[model samples]
Target: MRRVVFLVQPQVYLLDLAGPAEVFHTARDFGLPYELSYVADEPEIITAELLPVRCATTWPALGANDIIIVPGKQCATLEDVNPSERALSMLRAHHRQGGMVVSVCAATEALGRAGLLDGRRCATHHQLQDELAARYPAAEVVRDVLYTVDGNLATSAGIASGIDLTLHLIATWHGPTTAGRIARALVVYARRNGSDEQVSALLRHRSHLSDLVHRLQDVIDERYTEPLRLAELSRKFGCSERTITRRFRDATGLTPLRYQQALRLERAEHLIASGTTVEAAARAVGFSDSRTLRALRAAGRTAAAVAS
Candidate 1:
């Protein structure tokens, strides 16, 4: 079992702790062995929202595969946040032992205090990016990213982004399919990547509340690499093809086929970035040939340029 321990601090941001925790907790429902626990210097602390939270006073024995997450707290400045010396030492020792250390939002200040951010790429809340960089000059503070993972250290921009970061970690350990399922369970429209500064194609144009379109998007998300027919989808969803098509377009501003292609294209770009050949990436995403992929890529670039 992989133990995920949350290092809860005083004045903790509830969402920063709860969001990632829920992702791990939800993954257990899918047969992933994630053991959740919380630890803090005191047995009880109050949250930033003025809510009481109880936790274990003692830290658990962790192995290389274990994970420790430091949830962010409310503080006027990075210097105003003070973690116990023992906690800072524990953070350092955990990293030295090859265990993963994660920070959400301003809690990255704690990791920086522990000297873990030195010479590593890290991210924190946009408001603290400058302060983090100034304080930890040796660390490469990445801006405009949801999160950054360098070796065993992972830091997120905080708040809801913590959920995105945890989902990404789940995807890394398990697989994209498993992560996708969890996202669907959470009703998250899409899993944004660490590199995305804006909404992803999978997330864009998904603001409408049509249940049928949402369900159709979920199916396409899972089967984007396979041959999917609108007729088959219509029969499965008990709707006519024309109705499905019109509703999908009305809800997402794109036809179902276009939505599937967008997913395929997004994944193909990632594969190509990782050194896959154009033809191989196209084939991997269910394109009949590289020519279609190339044309789509060119069109996307032109559209982006026009938008800019």
Candidate 2:
């Protein structure tokens, strides 16, 4: 699970390559096992960014825990791909060996051409949704989505969605606590669970900056499990309650109390996902009772339903 092999191609989009790669790389910062390697059909490939990416020309053998990522290029059509038979064979072989195959943007073409998408549900950027279906009639080209997982194959939409999909994979493998730590460092606060609503609290209201708010956030990050009061926070930071509430809302779009609740809820979720009971997770995360957590989860469901 430590090794991640990226298959680079000429004219590949730099964001498409870096978005996912950086996710795994950032996970390493949180002490996750991640070793990255780059490979290509040639010694080097120029990106759409006008940058050169050099990689190993020879494909290495991969194991079940390893993953292969094929990022999309600047292709308007499938013919835009310079199909390397050896690269395709390596992809097919790795997949057959039970390794994960991840494709971003138009790189779904790689999976389709390798016969990996046949009758398998996959996804890509919104623009190429129709083209993927038209070209690979047997493949289910899901659209208007962040990512789709069909068994061992994971496909994602364009650009930023690559990071979202990679985070999902990391969460699945290592639990949400590890993923949440990485997302927080990346300044990504929220993620959609491929639900009907493609937004979440972690993603809302986050495009402003305030030192006061940041200081408060750092304190909350360290003491989310403790009972935190607005008056105490305001006094501790030498700010009035009005200024604290206003600035916090302006920066993060959540009240201080709600922000703390979100943090607790996220940790509670990770514990629950790791097989802790709802009751146990609630207690572990400093929830007074499981009923409160259930109410929060139910409210979240209602919010998503309304948003959708």
Candidate 3:
């Protein structure tokens, strides 16, 4: 059986712990064998957001070839949480030894504190956007997105976003069709994509950084409605065009043009899902016309169909 360990902590959000657990437990229906367990730094009764639950064993006692999930806690102060020390250590060690480590919401901060997020791209609750960015300057913090998977580390935003992240894992492990079936059985309309904003309107908070790169991101964020050109941005920054291109590519994987298009498409998708007319979405995202929009939509549909 594939093993899944939930490293439960004090004040852990019940849904964050349960949502992914339900997905892994239901793996049998998708023809995957899974053994799920709840673990902590010590084997004892612990109180979560809900009624007190007993942790069956210490993390060290768990076996291998499985997954470990760190659920979000209500508290933001991770440095003072002693319950996280052993659990975090185990999670890092497990991940280093090739185990999948999942962190939801504020729990992503624990992974950062444990040094697991160094040089990794991740997402977390937008409320902690500044905290995570300032705390781990080396880590790339993506706000608004539902989840991000950097190699073995998987992270999600706050609260119900855990459901989306968990269902994504199911799709990765089994297949999209199986995951869709499970979502239907569970009565969820669809699994939120990784790019979906889990913390809508909460990403206004940003880290205090002198990096001109942030200004670049801001320009893209605001001027997504306007035409974006790498040469124009380079001229604006007053540096060599090569320096601008290098810094922008280093900070974000895409060229400035591609990144702006991605943002526009993301907004377009949000409109489509929210009952907005396709034409409205096209105009809102600054597409030249509906011909390009329809083509993009068709391409996206084909990609999703292929993935499924």
Candidate 4:
């Protein structure tokens, strides 16, 4: 099995470590060929959360298919982090041997110290964008992006962007379908492109978990182009229309019809982004009337404006 090894650094932020770890763990739970492990330079490491982290001290033999992730730590400045040179060297050596290297948030500093980010496009937390560029003149720092992929190196933005970056990696290694499934299971809105900052309405509307809600989401996700009425959904899973409606709303804060419409609208947006006309985009996502599509577009704009 290909290993997904996390390199734990001292004074690390817990979420930066846990987010990507849970992502890979979910992939493994889905029966993917991934062995998740953690390595540390010392027997125990201190976290900014005040919780101590301890993992394997001995480094495992890595292969080309293996991935090594360096999660960002909590600090006001990069100087506050104290990762050992040996750990940074391990990342450089792994990359040199054709292995993939990933960095989360401030973890890009570790990559910078190892000379891995030099002359490569990378991303980090927005707060540290200028500092990253100044510290590593050769590294091209991409701002306002969840993550960036430059050759074997990948870097993600702060905090929650780690999940989006890991999902992208999953789609890269597995496929878009698998990544979508994982994201749905995790109830996360997957970003098709890091440059797009908006999350899909379907994902944002998810409030809780329910088996019926998940089943309905899977069907709508897999076949959003087809006609999927509420009655059809009710019949497919042997649940009455009333039960499905109430339960779905209780779990996801939206009706089944609205959820399906959200999927169609999200696809329409993507189609337009890829050079399709507004009418063509609407038709491409199962809308027969451009009038309703126009209204949906207007409503979307209104919602975004309200949020902004």
Candidate 5:
């Protein structure tokens, strides 16, 4: 069985680590042959969000694993958990021998600190974007997307984006049919393309902007599955149609309809990955009909397969 060794550290966010653990372990839930284990610099009890989790091996004691996953923590201080020279050297040695390293959220900082990100494009928690940029000038800090995969190195933005990254990894390794099954078991959107930005106007439209825009985004996100219209949405917000349209577009970079289309496509991708029929996914995302959805789905499938 292939082994994925999760390198846990103090202050590791439980979700960032656990999400992939569950995804990889439950591959049996979809009939894959792989195993996941937790390791660290020492056999330590780790805490995240004040929760406790245990590790079984120290980093140096770890053997050749198929993959190593490093997750993020809440610590804003880089100096605290940045990889030590020893850890950095070990990671470089593993990658030099063709091992895969997966870093989620701010854990990419450790990779950057090790000089592994110097010429690569990577993502992290949006809050730490500037710090990563200043710290690793040779690293191409990709601020736009949810995740990035350059060669054997894969990185993702904070929290939930990690799930998307893992799903993408599974999709790449096990084929879309298997990946969709795992995603369905997880009750998550199956596949947010690595190219998808974590802070797209659509995502930010729902949360990261001014209070009013944020509220509007919340409504759109919740009701995106239902039929939505500019006039109705404008009236609900107590604003004119034009004002709502302008503001929505400004906040999310896509008009309300286009934004909904993107959301539906995102959701459709999830459904399709979960083994749903393309027609069903299209209707679920509120497509006017199935033809366009099929066409779009075909185009996307072609693109992803080619990318792989």
Candidate 6:
């Protein structure tokens, strides 16, 4: 099993620790081979939110595929927070051994101090970006992005962005479909790859507050590859076909059938880009023939060309 170890520190941000932890935990629940653990220099650490958290004092043995995450903490400035040399050494040793090391928000300061950020591109919370850059001259501090991954070392902008970063990692390890399922379980949009234009079609058109439409979306997202009937959905949801169509359009600016087609088209594009043949991609995404997939691809290209 792949172990995910969170290196807990004093004044750790609660959300920074919980968000990614929940993503891994949820992924584990979905039968992924993941084990979550927490370690710290002491048995108890007081969080930034004034809550006491208990963790293991002894570090666990980690393999190359394992991960160690340093969650962001609360500090006035980089100088105000001093990490133990043992902790820094551990961070350096783990990365040197080819294990993955991650930092969230101000925790990038810890990675920076450990020399892991030297000549590496990293990201931190927006408020600490300037200070992180000034303190670590060798590190390239990326701005306006949720996270950055340089080799085995990764850094995120903390808080909710931590979730995005973790989801990205999950997608890398598993696939986009598994990550999308986990995101749906968390009631969040599927991982946004640090760009509005790159949001996954699995999560697009999900900003509305309509529970009915959202449920319809969940159904479509799960069964887009199958032949779904709006009348069946209307019967299942106890709504008229007209109501389902109107509400879906009102919430997402697309009918249910169109939304499902969008999912199929996006997935087909990914498969094709990954070297799958057009006919195979069409069959995989549930198209009856290559002609329909070709038509959709042509229309998509036309739309993009027009938009440009």
Cα lDDT computed for each candidate against the true fold: 0.90, 0.83, 0.73, 0.83, 0.74, 0.88
Model 5 whole-model lDDT (C-alpha atoms): 0.74
Tell me the lDDT of candidate 6: 0.88
Pairs of residues at least 3 apart in sequence or in different chains that clash in candidate 3: none
**Every model's TM-score:** 0.86, 0.80, 0.62, 0.72, 0.63, 0.80
- By lDDT, the best candidate is 1
| Separate clash counts for every candidate | 0, 2, 0, 0, 6, 0
> Which parts of model 4 have CA positions greater than 4 angstroms off?
189-193, 200-214, 222-308
- Residues 28-58, model 1: lDDT tens digits: 9999999999999999999999999999999
By summed lDDT, the worst window of 10 consecutive residues in model 2 runs over: 195-204
| Predicted candidate 5 versus true structure: per-residue lDDT over 50-121, tens digit per residue | 776777755533344478888887786555656557667767877776788889898998887766897999
lDDT-wise, the better of 1 and 6 is: 1
Candidate 3, residue 59: how far the Cα is off, in Å = 3.1
| Model 3 spans with C-alpha error above 4 angstroms | 42-50, 60-64, 80-82, 197-308
Worst 10 residues of 3 by lDDT: 199-208
Candidate 1 weakest lDDT stretch, 10 residues: 197-206
lDDT of 3 by residue, 167-243 (tens): 77776665444565566556565467888533211022122243776677677766777887777888888887788
lDDT of 6 by residue, 127-186 (tens): 999999999988999987989888899999878888988987886677667788898889
- How well does model 3 score by local distance difference test? 0.73
Per-residue error (Å), model 3, residue 286 = 34
User: What's the C-alpha lDDT at position 190 in model 4?
Assistant: 45
Residue 72, candidate 4: alpha-carbon lDDT: 93
Task: Report the candidate with higher TM-score, 1 versus 5.
Answer: 1
lDDT per residue as tens, model 4, 79-193: 7656787888888899999899999999998888888988899999999999999999998999889899888999999788888889878866775557777877786764546
Over 4 Å off in model 1, which ranges? 174-181, 187-197, 200-202, 273-280
**Better by lDDT, candidate 3 or 2:** 2
